[model samples]
Target: MSIIVLPQAFAYPAAAVVSTFWLTAYQMINVSIARKAAKIVYPQMYAEKAQAEASKEAFKFNCAQRAHQNTLEWLPQIIASTLIVGLKYPIPAAALCGLWTASRFLYTFGYTSGGPGKRSLLGNTAINAIVQLGFILGGSTYTVYQLLA
Candidate 1:
């Protein structure tokens, strides 16, 4: 492998770690805001015995939503990054890595605010395409380089 490619190969995993940190931060902030909003809106409901159960359920739903968002944001990046490292395609891998991170951000914002479905769907599709394309291109390039060498 070229010396330049070596560092780029390492960057794929590093980018994944950065993406994970971003996702976790986003989740924490989302849950915190949701919990605060729920508490303010349903303080009386939370206090009343009959309404307490409903409040609890609401809280649980908020938590679940946050978790879902986190998963949606991080899972693709993890998969793409891992593939990049394993397949040895730094350029496409890096591009996909960036796409995964960007999509996750878009997805998180869209999901949190209940934005239009098209935004989230587009983001998801873009990330998926990047990962798939990376895998194909990286594998092919690696094979060709090996044969030529």
Candidate 2:
């Protein structure tokens, strides 16, 4: 069996991955807190639409849960981009990953903030995440080209 060698720059991307994991945990904690405040019982993933419409607490909890759920949806791509692009372009990948994580944090906060127009509150935050993805994709493309060249 051949030993695989990874560059030291990989450390940065690895740390970014760890940060994303912690972010997930943090979002979970927010959901738990919101659930308690909203009296959302265990086994129910969300408040009913009518209940949420009638109760501010329920709306808050739903926002928090949605924020966490959205993060989970994007997580695989974040992890994959960080690691795959880091294989050949570690620093740039890590930078983009860090930005992506930060953007996600803001997006989650905006979603859970209980402000007007829940999603519209911080639409730019999503733009930031998308921009980071573009950069990560660029890095990934270069990495792939290098690997196959």
Candidate 3:
């Protein structure tokens, strides 16, 4: 069997992919700290029902958890698009991934700041994420098409 070789430029997007994991870890640590501050214990997703309804700390913890969860939802897509598109267009893929990661930071910080409404205080991070994903996905599609042709 022949060995498949990746172009050296792939390292750029590869680093971007690794950065997402670091971001994810950071979010997770935030959630852990928030959980402790809010007194949320293991096996519980959030504070007790009454605390959830009445406590700001509980809300903050929930937001931290949600931010990490949201990041996980997008992680596979982020890694896939970066690596796949990076095969042909490494620099652009890396740039898009970097922007996407930045948006996640904004999303988490804005969310964990106070309330759910505050999540958009920094900017419309969701839109930034969507736009970045669109570009990377488009590039990945083009790369696939070129490979198949």
Candidate 4:
């Protein structure tokens, strides 16, 4: 078996991968928080959902759940594209990865806050996420096209 040695140039892509993992874990933290909040605000043994909906804390918990769900939905795509795009385009990958990480951080706060206070941070919520998605998807697509063509 030939041992393939990746050079220092691969560091950036590796960092991109690590960054995504960090984001995933970070998002999970928010999920855990929301779960705990749901239990606290709606402490019915089997009516977590129903009780959560009725509680005044519903808005905050719901936002947290939504943020977690949104992260879950997008995570697969981000990881896939980040891996592929990072290999061939590490600079852009790193930048987008950073943006993705930062956006999730802001999203966690904005989501949990659930009020006008969080609204002040413009790109803190979604704009960064969209930009990250665009770059990751666009880069992945372009890389595939280039390879196939």
Query: By TM-score, who's the top model here?
Result: 3
Candidate 3, 72-92: lDDT as tens digits: 987887889888888888998
Against the true structure, candidate 3 reaches a TM-score of: 0.91
What lDDT score goes with residue 32 in model 3?
Answer: 93
TM-score of each: 0.53, 0.88, 0.91, 0.73
Against the reference, the lDDT scores of all candidates come to 0.55, 0.81, 0.84, 0.66
Which segments of candidate 1 are over 4 A away from where they belong? 1-9, 40-87, 115-123, 129-149
TM-score of structure candidate 1: 0.53
The C-alpha stretches of model 2 lying farther than 4 A from their native spots are 115-126, 135-137
Please say which candidate is ahead in lDDT: 2 or 3.
3
Instruction: Name every residue pair that clashes in candidate 4.
Output: none
In Å, residue 83's CA in model 3 sits off its true spot by: 0.4
Candidate 1 lDDT at 108 equals 60
**Candidate of highest lDDT:** 3
Candidate 1 weakest ten by summed lDDT: 43-52
Between candidates 3 and 4, the TM-score winner: 3
Off by over 4 Å in 4: 1-7, 40-53, 115-120
Model 4 per-residue lDDT tens digits across residues 43-104: 43222566656874655666666666677787777767766776667677777777776777
